[model samples]
Target chain A: MVRVTELTNLAVDLVDVHKTYRKTVQALRGVNVQVRRGEIFGLLGPNGAGKSTLVKIMMTVVRPDKLVGTILGRPLGNRKKLALIGYLPENHRFPPYLTGEELLDYYGALAKVPKAMRRRRAAELLEWVAMSKWAKTCVGEYSKGMMQRLGLVQALLNDPQLLVLDEPTDGLDPAGRRAVRELLLRLRSEGKTIFLNSHLLSELEMVCDRVSILVNGLVARQGTLRELTEHTVEYRITTTGDLAAVKEAVERCGARIDNTVIILNGHNVAKVNELIDLLRGKGVLIESVVPHRFSLEEVFMETLGTAR
Target chain B: MQFCALIVDSLRHALDRKLFWILVAITVLVTLMMLSIGFEGGKVSLFFGLVEAEVDSYDPLAASGKARLVGVVIYGLMDFFLGWVGITLVIIATAGLFPAMMESGVIDVVLSKPISRPVLFLYKYLASMVFVLIQAVLFVGFTFLVMGLRWGVWVPGYLLCIPLLVLLFSYVYCVSVLVAVLTRSTLAVILISLGAWVVFSGVRQAPAIFDTFPELQKHHVTHQVVRAVSWIPPKTADVTYLAAKWSNAGTSLDIIPASAMEDVSAAERGQLERSNQWEKEQLEISAFSSIGSSLLFEVFVVLLAMWKFTRMDF
Candidate 1:
């Protein structure tokens, strides 16, 4: 039994969603997720980990074996709810005969945008994606990266409250990747919820405020990066003095000295502070103290290994 | 709105496809060839001399069987080649319309919008029907035009055949769409459609196959069997039959009633009245079996396609 919530607060919520293709290949196994308003939520997973499958279930592109979900507080497959959401699939292909502008207009029209509004939005989206010059070019003539950008533009055409993207930046270059990141951030700033699935963990780390990682059709870990990685602590300490004294003080404070450096592991902030205080008392000048940010890749690998 | 958008997009895509143009060209060329063989001023003879002209077995009674010969030739050509072309062109064009779009991932983009599955299916089917109607009308109309030019007069009844042709061909297109949904491979769809076409058209011609089922051995049973196999092609045969009936009516032989043929130039008004009554009765019967079957088949196929399309995943 799923509880009904206020529409204005939650962008997307799925409880015990299950999807099996052809009565086999259980792509989603009781996956639960909730994306709050105005946050870029990343659905991170490897190939065949049900990333796209989950997105498809949410968008109603494919029916779920069992879907207990809601979008914007409305039940899934509700047309009124769908009008407020835009989706870009992993492999976004449009009718090759249609030009970029025409394709956008077609989707915009399908989304129930007025004719005048569709045309205006198509132009604005094309310009925003930096494909205004190629607006008239047929989609088949566009490169893979250009098609990806166009797909992103189409996804944004309706000014949807929630944007669902699967592998949105799969074929993008560095510059294109940066542009997409900025676009998502801007949308987030404008109070839009972005639900994204990507293989690029670094980009997810940069853009996503929260993320969920799935393994073998189940969510292995999910939370803000700060919450998930906070349990592991790493510190950088610089001090000028006799290295032997600093090392001795670090060892005395229950810290390990590695390569002439004092290292503190785990959530024992008291031990790190003790070492710092001892070094200061020894008249060893301290330069800087910084905590290393944990990369999502490392966290993901660790999570996957633990799940296995 | 979603349905309308889908229809517009489908129409645009269909118009832009190279296959559409190729089909149009082939239809025009075939119509021209049929026209050049001039429907009027053509002789229909049943016998040919084998070696030297040493008294061939042609009796004067069988010499001028022009109407039946023309009917057989026209129906045969329409059924075998032109009808096949129409069905094949439709299958090829619409075979990949939805299935290929799904396989190529384009359907995801479409479905991601606010469109409903049923609406998408309806609109695409409508678009395909419209295309079929346009192509079929053009083919039949231009053929009629060339026919009028060569024969020095246009047969008004030929225009009546347009709806029949459109209905039959649209049904085939609908079936192709359903087959496409069932198997999302264009090659497989073509093969299956062609096989179905062959089974419906050629299988009934074999006595053994018809004899296996006692129910199909009745008078109109073969028609029903053929209709069950592939409903559209036989409808084309029916349309051709109606057109032939109309063309035959314009001839002098058709003016004389079977009863009045013995007493030539006697009781002209009575013969004309009786002939008109008999023609009306024959027409009513033809319309029931031929035209009615075509209409029913089209409606059935359309509904079936819509149902399947709505239930399909993509």
Candidate 2:
């Protein structure tokens, strides 16, 4: 029953994953991550933060030195379970000689997708990615954005339950990125799990239901957007009147003054109320008071700084 | 299905290269050259009768002349051209397959598939042999048709060159894959595999070289070591002789025109006899030992390479 629940609830549950390259460079160290089923889960990290390495371990492209978890309800590296997973690696290379259709058919076949189904999926996916017109064109002639789009199509050829994409928007223009973003959301709506590893925090923030920020081979933070940013709330007060009159009073209230705005850190409603009362009593004309949440980039940078 | 996909993909890759067409063109030219030579009654005609030579004792209709023709096809075309030059060209064309497959962006997607790394490695190794297989089929198949239809001299055994050439190539290609998997460098694969081929041939011929010197042959210890070491590498030099022997092309000396040897001095004739004896001795090696031992070596190298591939971080 526990196994059944895990199988239904989590698409990926990795624990104590460790990987050291050439006996020295520790790409991952005691990293634990859990991705719920049917959600777009973003894995954010700076370069060398082991985000790609962790994804590689999950996809069985790179072996982990130590790991204890289940992927799609089976032990990690399960070949049969791999059939249910689709992976679009960063900077994926398709055979230059093969046309777009052939590349899909070839990788689909490797994933053990049957011929008829591969053909059908290839057609549907090419249309979905707006690549049907270029189906017959050789991959060598494709632009980088086209290659990235084709890579996404190839990953979905098997109609995998779990989609792991590393840098899916690496070379895409804004329009292409938006299309991919929408496609990712559509896949999630259809109950497919997406484990995205990328440096594009804004992209992930728009689509991901939850995210894990990896730093120096560890998960610095892992939670939903609200859960991660809830603690980082701040209230900014904009006033038409000069705040030099009540600057000392605002500082005494643990709020800092920056230009005409008073910045109050934390989610303390009473402290914000007290600051507002003091500003009003001083006859300062309050323009607006807004509670602001930290963006994913700020969270990522903070996590990175904390990890460092 | 995955294995079939790999093979088909390999075929497509081979077709993508200019070398494949160049090889096909070479085969066509060789076939045309073979077509230009005509056998008439008791004489030989070269280049559509542009040159003719009288054979007073050699009759094209005789059994001996037919055997000579078969010998020339086996030893000259199959053994020398396909076995040496064709194999080298195919090697250069295919030595990059594994390394290319292992390229950073390429390997990640491939290795993430449902297939096991060892199986993928082995399938890829076999797929590379498809290049040699296609070349051998074309070269031998075309020559066989030309010999049967044009010359009316059919030796069905000559068809064995197809598989024989593939086997010969496998002996060297196994080393090429091992190097490619280890280094993932195309240049390293090409250079080391070609170097290994030369070393394989040299080692296989060491025992024969020892027999030429009475002093070395008399040392039982050194002779035993040389003989034992010679059995270790794939017997690449023995493949041509095996093809000639298996195809029943007769001895290498049987292909010599009797008219041409008439004016040779006694000393030269003796040297020719000695060389013929050496060729005969090479042919006398048992087919089982030659092929079996060579296959064993190939299996070892392939398994070693597969182990490296399976255990690799890629």
Off by over 4 Å in 1: A1-8, A239-254, A278-287, B30-81, B148-151, B203-236, B242-314
| Chain A TM-score for predicted structure 1 | 0.89
Model 2: residues with Cα > 4 Å off, grouped in runs: A1-8, A242-245, B56-63, B253-274
Model 1 per-residue lDDT tens digits across residues B1-314: 66667777777878887878887897777676655453323332122212222222242213344333344444543454447666677767766676756674788877777777877777777766666667777776776676566544555666655665666666456557767777777787778766765654464234334434445557576656554654344444444445556655323223344544556665655546555554443334455765566567656766776677666564
Residue A136 lDDT in model 2?
Answer: 99
Worst 10 residues of 1 chain A by lDDT: A1-10
For candidate 2, give fnat to 2 decimals: 0.80
Among residues 3 or more apart in sequence or in different chains, the pairs in candidate 1 whose N, CA or C atoms overlap within 3 Å are none
Judged by DockQ cut-offs, the docking class of candidate 2 is high
lDDT of 1 at B216: 58
For candidate 2, lDDT tens digit of each residue in A6-105? 5468899899999999999999999999999999999988999998889888887889999988998888777888999989999788899999999998
Clash-forming residue pairs, model 2: none
Please write out the lDDT profile of model 1 over residues A1-308, one tens digit for every residue: 32446445778889898887788788999999989999999998877888888888888777888877678888887787788888888877778888988888788888888889888888888888889999999998999999999988888888899999988888999999999999999999999999999899999999999999998789999999888788765777766545675676577666775554666766667777887788778887777777775689988988888878
DockQ, cand. 1: 0.62
Q: B28-122 in candidate 2: lDDT tens per residue?
A: 99999889888887777989899997765545325467566667666787666886788788888988899989999999999889998888988
